[model samples]
Target: MNRIIAFLLLMTFCSCDFIEKKKVYSNDILDEELKTFNWNDVDEYPTFESCNSNLDNANKKKCFENTLRQILNDKLAKYEIIVSEEINDTVQLKITIDSQGTFVINNIVSNEVTQTEIPQLDSLLRKSLDSLPKIYPAIKRSQEVKTQFVFPVIIKIE
Candidate 1:
């Protein structure tokens, strides 16, 4: 009985050693496969140094930032809800902006929690977009540049 038990243990250990490991990953798989299928955003950002390179004053940069912030806040203020509470949420809101500073929201990438979709969240996003003073100030070359901007929107329920 002892000899038979020892032989069975030895066979179990030896059988697994002959098995091969297979690789699941291949280059043929697209990068998007790793990300969620429902979401859409630019894979990267572009630099047009020629347009912004001419900005020589720190005041101008600050002005650009402040102006953009106020514009966004004013738009969001129109919502009567208690948005006084600040929070950060990332959803892809696609923005189209020309170098001249004209901007508009083209589309919004939303959460898929509801079957019919929530319109309140969408309305808030639209209002916030209309408030942007400018997409950006004229760059060094003064040529109109088209760029996609992603907005981080937060929604709170009370």
Candidate 2:
């Protein structure tokens, strides 16, 4: 009986060693996920306090954009920027909202004519963001994320 039990134990140990180890292809899975993920899209757009959070994604985005544009328009209107030459161009304002909900001007793209005519354009744009309302950072996969916007500001000065 002891000999039979010893033989069974040895067989069990040997058989266990022969079993294949399950390999985890985590890198491959990660690569596939990255390829399928949309890098430009966010789960939620950043919102201001006035924007209704319960609204649908499209409405929420529109509200946030309109609110921001309105605010910027109102602020810019206060400044009587005098340009030496009649200018009609658009300025592309690259604004970035960080994960901390802080607003910053990443870059200001303006025509040389516009820049020369209104040297204070950059400063004015920067100042407009200073009075922005409390913002909620964009959410992606339930995590706060930084977002960038290329806002076009039409400059029509006569």
Candidate 3:
């Protein structure tokens, strides 16, 4: 009987250890979440003062683009560019807005004909961007992030 009782006690303790074993927590969920997250997308687009912050994401982006287009058009309109030949081309402006809300021109894509026709066009665009209104930086994951995009400006001069 004594031997049987000792065997039973040993069995109980071993089974208790097996049943009470702690599970090791893992970060697999976090890793999966990070992998699934879209890094290229921003939660909020950059904005100007005239753009309403309460607007939805799509409208906010539209307002920002429209405001920038209008400002550039107005500035360019002030310059009386008279070309010798009829020129019709689209100049793609590669622009970047830094995390600090500063505007930067990465590149200006224009054909040689356009460049030759308007030598001061590049400088004029740069100056126009320099005089832009204060901008708000884009937001991603609740943090300010830099954004870049290409804006096409059509040049039509008779």
lDDT of each residue in 63-117, candidate 3, tens digit only: 9999998999998899999889999999999999999999999999999999999
lDDT of all the models against the reference?
Answer: 0.54, 0.90, 0.92
RMSD of each: 14.7, 4.4, 3.3
Can you write out model 2's per-residue Cα lDDT over 45-141, one digit (the tens) per residue? Answer: 9999999889987888889889988988899999998878899999998989999999988999999999999999999988987889899998998
Candidate achieving higher lDDT, 2 or 3: 3
> What's the distance in Å from true for residue 19, model 3?
6.2
Per-residue lDDT value at 52 in model 3: 85
Best by lDDT: 3
TM-score of each: 0.43, 0.82, 0.81
User: What lDDT tens digits, residue by residue, belong to model 1 across residues 15-38?
Assistant: 787785766666536564655443
**Model 3 misplacement above 4 A:** 1-30
